[model samples]
Target: MFRRTFWFTAGAAAGVWATTKVNRKLKQLTPESLAATAANKAIDAGHRLKDFAVDVRDGMAQREAELGDALGLNDQDAPELPPQRRIAAIENRTYPKYTYNRNEDH
Candidate 1:
């Protein structure tokens, strides 16, 4: 009789454990749970990507400053790069406009 009772108790415990596990798995598999998980992961990825972009921009600016120092760009009397390389007159050159006479078409 004691053996039967022990078996019965063990079976009930096993059944309860299995039911709890199944319910938890079902909750995780539901649409709302899946969508929330995906959204959280996406937000985490976006934050990481934004951080990477910020780091890259900072590195570029630092490298640019280092190069400028090497090239004497910070000196007051140093010739500038792009400003001195411009040709303003060629950019401003224009052609005379020709008017069409109606009497010439005839």
Candidate 2:
């Protein structure tokens, strides 16, 4: 029984030492793996940027068509007034007011 217990303790110590050595090696190898991962991420970002640019161009074209219809202007016609100026020309303009101010006393 004593012999068996001694062997079991020794085996557990050896396993712990082997795991520590393997973990050290893995830590040493990780920086190169991280750099390669970053390079792959940059390549993916470039593809995403290209896709986003195309989406923005298509969205702008659709928005311009909708705005032209709403304002009774032809698609080819440039409006005499800018959008912000047109909004300001409308009646019953009221600025937003806060009901409560945290810093002010009631």
Candidate 3:
């Protein structure tokens, strides 16, 4: 009789726990809840990405400074390349005249 009572109590507790879990899941599955959850996650991811980018920029600047100091480049003026090697965005390029006929009907 005592063993039977113990088993009955345990089963009732399990049922209550399962029902609570299901209800919580159903609530989360609702459209509004899902959207809010997704938006929150997206905002969190955006913040993480922004942080990562800032860290990368900071590290890059630090590395550049270290390299410049090691190479004694900080004290000198930047060198200028010869005119032939320089390219300007406003410069126009000339393309070679071309002709191609790959069609057998040509």
Candidate 4:
């Protein structure tokens, strides 16, 4: 009698555990859950891509400087406009605006 009861209790516990696992898996497979998982993965990929681009840019700049140094190039000789001069150039630009009058030549 004790052996039979022990086996039955074990079987019932196993069944409950299996059902709980299956239900959890089914919930994860639902459309909304799947969409959320995909969105999270996509966001992770975008961040990885942006990080890769920044790394590539920094590496390119470093390599260019190294090559310039090997070729005996001088970067300091290049002319650079000052901030005030640049701003003055931009401020000197003119734009014209026109208004139409209904009473004028129709």
Candidate 5:
């Protein structure tokens, strides 16, 4: 009688453990749970990307300042211009024009 009781208790414990594991897996596979996990990963990636962009911008600015010091350009002489003024300055530069003659053979 004691042996039979022990076997029954062991079986019951195994069944309970198996049921708990299967239920946990099913919960993870549900649509809402899957979407929430994916969204969390995406938000984490976005934060990492933002931090990387800020670091790159800061490094570029530091390099620019170092180059200015090497070239003996002071802040007053080389004031930082807004995007519109920079575009205008680039557009205002003059380059020598070249004429192309297709009929001339070399």
Candidate 6:
């Protein structure tokens, strides 16, 4: 009875090992399946990038229109301003000192 039980356990282990080897061989036989999966992923990524570009362009146009309205100018008449010039204007007009206390102590 003990010998029979040992043989049965060994057969089950061998069956599992053989099944894994067959599965690996089957995957190796189908190269086109792997290539198709990679191509599909690339196409998906390209579509997502195109969508993002359209969204960014739309947002920038909307923001420019709003800024033109606030400045009391038509969108076509709005003057183009560089970011650096705007920053410099704000920095020059705004005081940097935090307090009027000129004394070093007290």
User: For each candidate, C-alpha RMSD in Å?
Assistant: 7.0, 12.9, 6.3, 6.9, 8.6, 12.7
State, as a TM-score between 0 and 1, how close model 2 is to the true structure. 0.42
TM-score for all models, in order of appearance: 0.61, 0.42, 0.66, 0.68, 0.58, 0.45
Specify the poorest-scoring 10-residue window by lDDT in model 2. Answer: 79-88
Report the C-alpha lDDT of model 2 over 1-106, residue by residue, as the tens digit: 9999999999999999999999988875798877887889999999999999999999999999889889877745674775564345667889898698777875
Q: Mind giving the per-residue lDDT tens digits that candidate 3 earns over 1-106?
A: 9999999999999999999999999999999999999999999999999999999999999999999999999879989876786666865878798777678555
List the global CA lDDT of all models: 0.93, 0.88, 0.95, 0.92, 0.92, 0.85
For residue 34, what is the lDDT in candidate 6?
76
lDDT of 6: 0.85
Models ranked on lDDT: 3, 1, 4, 5, 2, 6
Question: What lDDT does model 4 reach?
Answer: 0.92
Off by over 4 Å in 5: 1-11, 79-106
Instruction: Give the Cα RMSD of candidate 1.
Output: 7.0
Angstrom error of the Cα, residue 53, model 1: value is 0.7
Model 1 clash tally, residue pairs: 0
Clashes of each: 0, 0, 0, 0, 0, 0
lDDT of 5 by residue, 22-52 (tens): 9999999999999999999999999999999
- Estimate the TM-score for candidate 1: 0.61
